[model samples]
Target: MTASHAPFIAACTELLGASHVLTHDHDTEPFLVDWRKRYRGNACAVLLPADTAEVAAVVGLAHEHGVAIVPQGGNTGLAGGATPDESGAQAVLSLRRLNRIRGIDPHNNTITVEAGVVLAEVQSRAESAQRLFALSLAAEGSCTIGGNLSTNAGGTGVLRYGNTRELCLGLEVVTPQGDIWDGLRGLRKDNTGYDLRDLYIGAEGTLGIITAAVMKLHPAPVARVTALAGLASPHAALDFLAMAQRHAGALLTGFELMSDFSMRLVGRHFPQLRYPFGEPHAQTVLLELSDSESDEHARALFERLMEQAMEEGIVEDAVVAESLAQSQAFWDLREHIPLAQAEEGLNIKHDIAVPISSIGRFIEETDAIIARATPGARMVTFGHLGDGNLHYNVQAPEGVDQKQFLEAFQTPINALVYDQVHAHRGSISAEHGLGQLKVDEAMHYKSAVEVRLMQSIKAALDPENRMNPGKVVRWAQAGTRKENIA
Candidate 1:
């Protein structure tokens, strides 16, 4: 440890036992890097606080020392939001020890969980209670609820259950100044003052540490229908989605659009997983119909929609999973696309979102630009079509060097795609927060007034620039506090 931060480490060890204070470089190395391994950082120590009170004490200590605090959970965030900076002047606050389910109220349809609880555990608890917590992602197995809430994560079910922000009812937070804001109420309505709970939800811990939350739950779906439909293009996929909505309405829980390239990568890298179709189509959409009705009803609805889509030529061929295992198999293909991509090589991923009405145009125009600029670069596009979130990613050409392709064109490719998204009045980041990855990207796309307002709020809540500094919004100085957060 540095001589300058020796006192800081001693204080942290005194607050929480020496066992919980990770000071050695090897012990703190794992917490310094991100899940994608794209960002590596350094930290003086990692503080593992077991409860809200301990977290409060640690935050107060950091504030007193003027040392930066980076709150980390499972560290599964793609945007580097939870990773510390490389200055080694910061303390990584790990919240994994606080994993607990405080309570579950079946009648109120709410589950109060500690921030360190894994998301899958919350879903399993809801299932045990015969209810559902619908915030799901590929990283749910390890990603903590605190990380999910902090990023306001959106997954396939966002079309139906809404993002983490909508799923959240209340939050227990520890501010940068070490004050605890106990807003953990299960009430559905509370308009007494400003929506403080929301301000912290997607703040990426730049504002405060989310220690616990009261999340909403829904009745478990009695029946679910999973299907894969082949489409001519993204336009046809959009049409097929509208047709399913016309037929199934709210039962259309998930609608994911995947290019044939995505499936091919999965099929090639993962030999055990195969494409269900006899032949590959340029475009395909995974249809999931779920409801509280009978299995027969849901399956029939899925079949009816597929038949009509084929008749209208929106879908060429389709397969409706007849059994529960088959449905899981269909989902496994969609969930493992990223894994297959990782097996192949590195690629630039753009998590952009546009209006459903503009999805087709965004795809065609963006692809054309990419094709013209970087010929033969494969477009591996797919995502939650129901919410207009597209994982528009580009793989290096078969013959071109991956590093050369990315280093040469990653910036231009991002600009082309983001320009298309902006033309449609869409977002540069759909589910993932800006973190350090897209702070400048967000500022470029967002309006001046919008950017200024965000900076003002960041300045107001964290005047000293102590909490997760250099994230979300760039700060001015320690004393340059804005007067209004609103």
Candidate 2:
């Protein structure tokens, strides 16, 4: 470490015990890298604070020293938002030590928790109280509440419970200047002024650190039924979606679309999970219904929907889970796509969203263009069809070197896909925030006015730009502006 940075390090070691201040490379390596291992940053030190007060103190110390602080929770972020830059000058403030479920108000239907609490733990706690906290995701076992809010994570439950932003009611954030803003109100409606809570959530720590949150909970569903439908094409899947929605309404909780190629990838990697269909179809959909009444009610609804779908020839074949174990098995097929993709090789990944009505056309046109440009390219397309979000990923051509394929086609392929998304009036990013990966691309697609407004907000809240620099919105002059965040 440099002599100039010694004082800052010593101060942090003093504020948080030396045991909590990790400076050695071996001790700090895990916090420096992201879950995907795509981003590896450097930090002068990794600080772990035990509570909100300790966090505030650590942030204050960093602010006084003019050291950049990257707030991280669980280090499970896919977009590299929680990782520091390569400068080795920033300090990583890890929030994993702050885990605590403060209280569960069963009557109010709200649960207050520290940001470090894992997503699955929240669900379990809510369930224990005869309530449901429904921000479900693949990383729920490890990802923290703070990370979910920062990325505004969306999972299968988004169709009914909405995204993390919709499920959250309040947040306690530590701002760039080391001041705590306790806006943690559990009220369903609070329209007094500007929403400061929202400013921190989904900001990716660019503005401030989210320490805790008050999340909304719902009554536990009496029964949840899952089904897999084999369809001829994306058009047929869309028709099934419309029909299912008409029949189930809000009870339709999860709807996912998986391309035939995607299913094949799963089958190739995980041979044990048998494909539910007799023959391969062009597209397949996984449907879920959460009935508040009973299993019989859910079964009746599914029977009518499946009967009509088969009679109309919308679905070639379908299978509904008869038990909970079978339902989980159906979900396992959908969730294993990402893992299978990793097993195949390095590929281009896109978390995008288009109008629900326009998804089939978008996929058809974009897939054709990708195929023509890069002949033999395999498409692994699947995601939350109910909410119009697709994990539209591109795989290397069979028999080609995966690394070489990504090196040559990642940029051009991304451009092609994004252009089509823009044409369809869709978003380049659906759930994952634009970390360092998509920052420049987001700028290219966003209008000048929108960019300026975002920059203005960044400048206003974190004028110094010491809070997670080089993320979301980039400021030409960072760490200089001294405007009050208030």
Candidate 3:
């Protein structure tokens, strides 16, 4: 450790316990790397603060020492947002120890929790209260609410509820200046002033560290139904999506589109996960309905929708899960695509969103472009079709070295996909924030005015540029201070 860093570490240890201040490599390794292992960093120590007060104190100490702070939660972020840099100067501030469910107001349909609380735990708590916290994803078991709010995460339930930003009504944040801002008001309408809550929600800790949040909740659905349908093409999937919306209306809670290749990948990796359809179609969709009525009513509605869709030739074939186990099995196929891709090897991943009407053409054109660019490159395509966000990923062809393929095509493929996304009036990042992975690319796509505005906000909030630097937006010129930008 450097002579200058010792005092900072000692002060942190004094504030918390020596055990809470982890300096050993073995104890700090997990916080240094991201979930995908795409980013590996070095930190002098890992600080575990027990509550928001402790967190504020640690921030104050870091500010005093001029030590950069990387606020991390769960470390499941795909964009390397939570990972520290290779520089050993920074300290990782982990929120895992601040996990506490403060309150649950069932009457107001709101739940307040510390940022370190797991997403699934929030769901379970809401269920216990006979309410529902609808922000859900495949990583719910381990991903924390703080990380979700930081990235404004959107999961399957966005079609019915909304993204994490929508689910959250308020936040308590520790600013870079070592001050706490508590905006934890559960009011549905608070048109008080400029919305500081939103500024921190999707800021990815560049502005401040989100400590706790007051999340909106809804009455739990009485019955839930899941169905999988095979379609001839992406165009057909869009048609079926429109029809499902018309039939089920608000009851249609989730709608995910999966390509036949994606299904095959899942089936190849997990042989036991049975494909619901006998024959493979070009595209498949998994649509869900949450009924306030009864299971029979949901089933009848789904059957009617399927019959009409099939009769109109919008759906080639369909199957509705008869039991909860079967429904989970159906979702298992959808959720396992990323896992299967991981098993396959390292690949270029793009979390993109396009206009719902343009998805088919976008995929059709982009897939053809990718094929012509690199033959035998496998595309793993699937996501929330209802929301127009797709996890469009490219894998190395069979018998090819994964590392070599990524090194060869990651750049060009990203450009091609992002170009198409821009052409279709879409976003290169839908749910995942632009961590180190896409921060530069975001600069290229965003207008100068837009980039400047973001820079101004970062300068105003975190002038020192010490909070999770080099992740989101960057200064216009390298090594330039906030004053130079203005």
Clashes of 3: 0
Error of 3 at 364 (Å): 0.3
lDDT of 1 by residue, 66-85 (tens): 78999999999999998988
Best by lDDT: 3
67 Cα displacement, candidate 1 (Å): 0.8
TM-scores, all models, native as reference = 0.97, 0.97, 0.97
Model 2 misplacement above 4 A: 477-486
Off by over 4 Å in 3: 476-486
Worst 10 residues of 2 by lDDT: 477-486
Steric clash pairs (candidate 3): none
Q: What TM-score number comes out for model 3?
A: 0.97
Worst 10 residues of 1 by lDDT: 477-486
- Against the true structure, candidate 1 reaches a TM-score of 0.97
User: Candidate 3: minimum summed lDDT over ten consecutive residues — where?
Assistant: 477-486
